[model samples]
Target chain A: MSTRPLALLLLALACTLRPAEDHVRLDERVGRAETPDTLVLEEDGLAAIREATPRGARLWAASPVLHLRLRTAGGPFELVVRNTLRDATLTLDDGTVIEREPGGLPTEARFVLDLPAGVERTARLAPPDADAAGSFHVAVLSDVQDAIGEVQDIYERMRADPSLRFVVSTGDLTDSGTRAQLVRFQEELETLPIPLYSTVGNHEVPGPEAWHDLFGPFNAFFRFRGVAFSLVDSSTATVDPALRRERLRPWLEAHRDAPHLFLTHVPILDASGLRSGAFRSRNEAASLLQELADAEVDALFFGHVHSYYAYSLAGIESYIAGGGGAIEEELDGIGRHYLRVEVDGARGVLGVGLVRVD
Target chain B: MTRRHGRRAQVTAHLLLALVAAGLPAARVAAQAPRTDPSADAPAEPPPPEAEPPRCSRARRRAAPALALTAGLLLHGTGHLLACERRTGRRLLAAEGLGFGALVLGGGGIALTGASRKTVAPFATLAILGVGTFAASWLADLYGTLSGGANAGRPARAAPFELALGYRYVHDPQFAYGHGLHLAAEGWLHRTRLFGGAWLALDDDTQRATAGLSQRLLGARGRGDALDAEAALHGQRFGTDGFRTLGVDVLLRGRLELAHLGPTLAGSFVEAEVGLGLQGFGYDATGRGVREDWNGLLLGRVGWGVFLGPSGELVAYYDHRRDDLAGGLSVDSVASGVLGHFGLAGRGYIRDGRWGLAGELELGSALVVGLSVLHRGAAPREGGAR
Candidate 1:
């Protein structure tokens, strides 16, 4: 064949070798910009309650206090604290002097409910005649991105045991919150067979509208089982003095009563006692967290900074589940993992397991 | 030029025909392996109690892509040796001889690995290409005469078709600052001698094809085989993010092609050259002289090919070139000829990944390099990821 004809033939062959597919779908799920209906906070209506007055704290104020008015099975309970610091002690309603550290409520501190001397064993543990109640299990997961296999593995493990009541994602549900990314999360969790709750992290807030929409009905401050779980908006954690004093203070005071499990994105004040502020703020917001910790809140779970960090502060136990998402680099001490919590009656047992999926 | 173009067209067509004949049949075999839906029979198979698939041998998985790439390189090498216009008959014979030897070695390596262990295919193919490069480089040193004309002595440039396949491993010294190093199969095929006209094959489906022709003319030189001037006319293309590129380079290379090595390798020439390439950056396929800039390159090479032999013998000393992109994005064009191919068994040359350096000049620019590693066996398939 002539060179022209031969060239034409080769061109034809090259053209015929069309690629298998033209558009390679990339990971593009930026999640629903607005809260999805299922994730909204509608079921727990009391969470909708707004405080009549805005409350706050001042650093200059001497000896700030957290007034605790919690009601247990036996009767109404009240404790008093003078300041927010390490090893602060609390006096229980029954004049029980508890030498409390500025960490989770003393692990051994438990109220031995008074029951009839001849009460049945079942009734003793679960009193049908109790004045106070407890029946909520919140799932806490961290560092769920970057390692899809690990996430899937954890999800599968959870699925095997249907006892899992509900799930709480500490934060960092994604490496990058691309649209498809959120979809992957939703698809993986759809098999969970229970509602999944999320506390907003820096990753979740590239824009308020998107995250607020993705976790709609389930995204609100609400009471689950019986414990009140509060999600502290990172927006309120900013260095903006006005936002800190005006916004966060009121939110904390209004939800002070019920057995509380606080959720936050960033860990407050590193071991060196320095606080991080959003938008380049300093330790200004540390006092607010101190006040809450003094109130003897339940475990506070957080994500971001993919590593496992646990600390105790003013009668409160704080657990960091940052390993729930993508882990960019290996930490000196922590591996990727999720916390499986078994909560029954008044006490909860937390176990951490490092999971890997091929 | 017309005769050269005609021969190239013929060879390309022949290669295309051969590739199609070989690739289509194997593709059919794969297509027949039950493409309908394995998910349908799930009820009977009962998911393997194990949740994840066992780790398969990496060599087995990479075989198809390896073969495809290897074949492409051999075909490309053959095209260049046959179509090059300025090369002497002796040089041409040696180039073809080297190319054929590379194909045989690469093929044998693949088959041996397959018969014994699947993991050795990529390494085998890499060995084949390494040897083939040395042959071509040595041949270039012989027949490619220098321009002793107006400016000074420089090699008469030949636009040989260049193609290669290899496996690559890269690691950045600064761990925290940049992305981690990765292992990938890569290849590139080009028909321009200026190192300016080439299509990079990243993975399998993505091919960044350079549009337009590039011409490099020789110029004056100083001692030590250095060139005084070099020129080029290239087309460029840029797509998404920092990957934006589509510009032509027009340069006058002031470098020598043959170097005078003393007595050991008598009359065997070894040369080094360096010069500036006036580059034009624009959004045109025909990369003709557009918005131009002075881009520089440095080349050094040496070879010894006997005048008579069934398969002309030549030792390719070295061939290296570097180009810098003005402003923030600078690319260092390189093609080094390693001493010997130890892993695949024989005396051969190796072309490390084509590295492009960026970042702080004081600390030296960061590099994004390309590699083409091959092993012996049936030639790797050409239509998949490298």
Candidate 2:
């Protein structure tokens, strides 16, 4: 069959994106963007009451900060930090303590910020006594496709481990990428103690405008301590070589010298060697694997397989940890688990510990 | 891709450490250790040798006949009868060619009717005819091949026409009661065979016709019994019990003989079937389509078949289909697979959504207690050279 018409139809659909509305509903909270930089946080039509950051911390001056974009505007702004978080310490660039209200659920850390516009601002919320260096843990999860019923136990298990800094997933957040499904997943995620960062999966699908509003970007990269975590949106089950060369190459090049990890929804090369399981073309997979090899990436993480498999691809340590509450592959011995990867700032990946529900 | 079978990772790690400590060449050690290790959770066992395939005495005997069936398909449906009847082989080949030609012609018609739904029926009809003919020809060639077995002493006796009779009871929600006398026949077309059956209502006037064609492809020995491959096409018209349903399926399946499983399973075999085709409804007198509405369908079935000596065979299976064909008699309603129905109460027998469990026995080769059948492994060898 000729593919021209189908391609054109997809192209036409991609061109039309729904405009954003005034209010954005995030998990349980609904709020409007107060300014281009700040967001006002409220619940149940409650007055926007915020606590101030202790006098010592000179960073964010508000109680709890929804989001603080660095100096986007001249501000004698007030940051409203949510009181729900347990004993939390907020910090900014240059080692400045932004908020330290002790570990209490009720006390809000309202801080008054006097900042000049037009500079970069990067601050992170970490537990009060977390080590500034050495080993850190990242929980890897994926394929929670409406297996919402069984996922609560998974979250509870994760909550029991305080050492896991953040949860990262190679997405399948919903069975079908619908707004309601996405919201439901978020509601379930709220039970987790930390945030989860994810790249979309084929199940999440492309062309869902809510994808952008829910997740950050199609492709994203961020560094923690010295390790670069790069995510390329290979959600279509096939990674076109041109896309790999153009978009993914730059990120690989920039992070080549650092301890780097790659994450995507579909495995670039299925270790199973089943043509039915992997990408459409072997050449594409080969090209992407070659690129990862050249960059000397430390480890590759993938989901889609709905089973846990550990192997090496193009000399890089790769793991498929799709044990998140989805239907287990036939004869794969169903087990719900996530990979707890410990990364050292000076060294590369220390070890990957498979923590299971049992 | 080699399927490594143990704590290969731990072994490899130890090997590398030992080599490093002993100042041995890393390349040599690396070459000895396989790169592809099976899933870590997989049970460990010694890897098979890289020599000739392991086989049993029975498998060695059936190799010749299995090869002949393979040759038939490779020879465009002529090889099966080549060792038996030259004229039959030539006719089977001719039928195969005609069917293939019809399929291509239908494909061309579809191209001509591109974006024009008005002319699809003609092409659709041609395509259906092509597949039907293909199935008939293959079944014909297979029967000639089945009779050409190396174990001629134990081979099934050929009858010009075979008749079978049986009885069955079905507890379907749509039909309060369904049980009747089942009668079926197998008629030979030259060397090929076609099967047709009907279940007459003993109590109610709900009658249905079951028709199908099947052919063996090849086989190879596994352990003590043979593994085989078969291609089949079947259709059912369900006006029985006031359910007007018509469904046709085509499958290319593989099976293993009962003995290969264990000494106790000497007369039964297991099979897995994957099929995709079209199905729809509406039937009239003459047991053919009156007005049809077709939709693409996907299906999978895993079954167990037991040879009841000369009494034919009995097959029990669990089927999964993307469509709910039997008036939604089974509907799990979840937009998910097997695990999705979790937490739901009482998702019964034929999983309502896309899964069903059924069992039936064929009375001789002529009568069937159910619409489905699990092809048997006739050869001593299993399918493939493996």
Candidate 3:
């Protein structure tokens, strides 16, 4: 009947038009340019180019390292990079040194470069000692909702740790995830001496469309030193099937032989199933854990419950660090804190120690 | 199954059976209670005067259902006790105690084991059965107080055989499939029911199929009041996602006629099922060709329904499994992980009970709507009349 065909057509249209807002777009957007003057990101990392022109560009880098390509007109050009780790190094193609200007915000790294007109050059910006990779320390923090005013103290404490490379987060950088709240959270980050890479949390669902533009992406993968870090979005308590297939499978495969640390906004399975601060589907969670185990991931980190927990899931070391001044879990002596994880290129994860800020 | 697993399964099965059996005899007695006084046939001798049974006050009768909605919701039998159905009330309360015991033991086991794959299935099964029994007792208590012992012992019958073909629409932002063809067939063989169904996507390669057999454990076949033990095999392929799953589950399902509880509940029934399963997922992508994983599934369902005429019924249900196409609801809180989906479904005959229409709506992370045209064979001669 005519009705059946009409119904089929409507179904097709609905399926085609379903909102596909997920982290996969961020993966595809990197290393792509809309115009010749636009900066092109090359690595599987999280960064956003805020402004681009013929002579200069300003960018925000959430990941510790950025591999980019850009074209510039002849003469001196100013490249301002914000939200970068301390002691970042900028170099031209194949290690040509470019010094950063002094006396800027501790989290900002400003570079001035001179180049020939109409020439495109590759640029690599990273920590000075990133490649040495014997053993390094990184801090993990999350759940700063409602506590944005007090998060700076935790950052200050991390700044005091000279060995900490950068901070990684599971999400909940803001209480409401509004653009204004996100911007305010970013403003507070200016005081930190290190960069923070994060996935979005459930708090961000109210404004899901805004987070991609502000935080780079909900799901991203990057390699630092010798460790592979994959940040996935479980803010909705489930991963989009397309994301699981298109991005996660490949990321896990690519890092199968390396030391991989998986981070997400929600734990795949709550430890006791009492709090249920985990994925909506236990079957999906168990399947994912099996995959992680099969891939031999080194560790997993999550933040949602406002407390600290260290446990093993599917034989992988896991931790939940949500002590960023949110409503604290009552009765527990511990308060605001973060995790300091040490990993070695050859030896895998060495230790994860809890650093209390309150 | 291994020896240890078999032993655990036996233990879990015994626990569930004990909980269910606690209410079985009482239900049977209530069902078989005499509808008419046999003494009418006796010679008319001067009847000995007997003290009338204490009557429920009008105020107490009015308050019974309200109490069921409040205190009885948690205590499981307050309303029945208030209505002076002390024997049934005590049985319900005892059932609730056993249910809570199973819940504690199963939940404690899962917590202590960290939900380890080796021991999760039996523990989860026990827990689901516990929750189902607990809820059923509460519902029974409410029905007993509200129905007022009217229209006692009426039975509802189901068609002995049926075949259906239908169209299904699914809307999920996470996947690409939208349209599907639904096919199902079910028939009774003596005291057992055999059933199979499939959902094939028209716009994508997604396909799912399930086949099962259920044996009547108590009550008569084709009757509303029955207990069944079912074993089913399930398979699904998510072509858009390049993954497939295969699994098997064993469930104990029961449907109790509400008329046994009270008159207002006549022609209505309550159903509950609890089960456990294990599923294996395999990926079809290039790098994931060798990638496979397994998961333990805890399945539970509870429903309340009313019979339509002699061969049709409408039901509203809550399903606690997430592996189906409907999946679990997505929310910003942990409750998303703890709860599943709710659904409404109905079936009715139009052509002398040989042809019928069926429809369903399910609400979860996705929305699923389905409508079917069905044909049924002749009903069995015995047990076909209501």
Q: Which model scores highest in TM-score?
A: 3
Q: Write the per-residue lDDT of candidate 3 for residues B149-261, one digit (tens) a residue.
A: 55233333556788999999987766678999999999888778999999999998889999999998776666477778999998887766556778888888887765554
Write model 2 residue lDDT over A1-358, tens digit each, in one string: 9999999964442221101110111211312234444433322211222222222121211111233333435466555444223445557666787764344223235545555564546555545534346878889999888576668888898889988877778888788778788778866766776667777676766334565555435555666667778766556544433345455678789888878889987776555431123433222343355567668889999987767788876567899888886654434564678999999767899999888873
Q: DockQ winner between 1 and 3, please give it.
A: 3
For model 1, what is the alpha-carbon lDDT of residue A161?
55
Clashes of each: 108, 34, 1
* Stretch of 10 with least lDDT, candidate 3 chain B: B41-50
Candidate 2 vs candidate 3: which has greater DockQ? 3
Predicted structure 1: clash tally: 108
In candidate 3, what are the lDDT values of residues A1-358, reduced to their tens digit? 4699999976654432232243455546633343554344546546766666766777777677888776676687788888787788798896798888998887788988887766788888888776766889999899898788778789889878989888899888888789999999998988887788888787776676567666666777888887899888887777767787778888899888889889988888665343455676554665576667777899999988777888877667889888887665544566799999999877899999999987
| Off by more than 4 A, model 1 | A1-132, A217-219, A235-251, A271-282, A328-333, A342-358, B1-386
Q: Which CAPRI tier for candidate 2? A: incorrect
Model 2 lDDT tens row, B3-99: 1112334444554454344223223322443333333222122233223224334443345246445765544345433343443444445545555
- Which consecutive 10 residues in model 1 chain B have the weakest lDDT in total? B327-336
Model 1, range A28-97, lDDT digits (tens) per residue? Answer: 1111111211111111221111111112111100111122222222221212221122223334345554
Q: State the DockQ, from 0 to 1, for candidate 3.
A: 0.13
- Overall lDDT per candidate, in order of appearance: 0.33, 0.49, 0.72
After superposing candidate 3, which stretches have Cα over 4 Å from the reference? A1-45, A53-56, A73-76, A150-153, A241-246, A269-296, A305-337, A353-358, B1-156, B159-310, B313-320, B331-339, B342-344, B354-386
